[model samples]
Target: MTTPADTTAPPPRRALTAFAWFWVGAPLCWGLYELGVKAAQLFTG
Candidate 1:
């Protein structure tokens, strides 16, 4: 019988993608939090 193809990405590539997303997402989350807090303060102060 013939073997099937390995269609998924390699481990190193997956790790790199995850690491890149973490770096990209973390700052966006922090910036959004900061904006939310500033807006709250502006309305309440």
Candidate 2:
């Protein structure tokens, strides 16, 4: 007997939720702020 074709749908994607985004983005924002302050000091000093 022939085998039947697969009919199941693909699995859902793993998306980044808001809480995860905040956790990841907070440090990045802090680093950018610090870099901007340092660059300003270099220009003024």
Candidate 3:
């Protein structure tokens, strides 16, 4: 009889995860900052 296959998945790499977040989070924060600046101007002006 043939053996059953392995079902478990591999764990993620920490460095790659952090690098991915940095690349993704920077632009997201910048967008939020710009939006806040616009909103402040809209309310104050």
Question: Which has the higher lDDT value, candidate number 1 or candidate number 3?
Answer: 3
The digit string of per-residue lDDT tens for model 3 on 1-45 reads 233457454554678879999999999999999999999997898
The number of clashing residue pairs in model 1 is 0
What ranges in model 1 sit over 4 Å off? 1-12
Candidate with the greatest TM-score versus the true structure: 3
Q: Return the TM-score for each candidate structure.
A: 0.57, 0.57, 0.65
**Candidate 3 deviant stretches above 4 angstroms:** 1-12
Off by over 4 Å in 2: 1-16
lDDT by residue for model 2 (1-45), tens: 233457565443335456788898999999999999999998898
Clashing pairs in 1: none
C-alpha-based local distance difference test score of model 2: 0.75
Candidates' RMSD to native:
6.6, 9.0, 7.4
Separately for all candidates shown, the number of backbone clashes (residues 3 or more apart, or on different chains) is 0, 0, 0
> Tens digit of lDDT per residue, candidate 1, span 1-45?
233458554345667778999999999999999999999988898
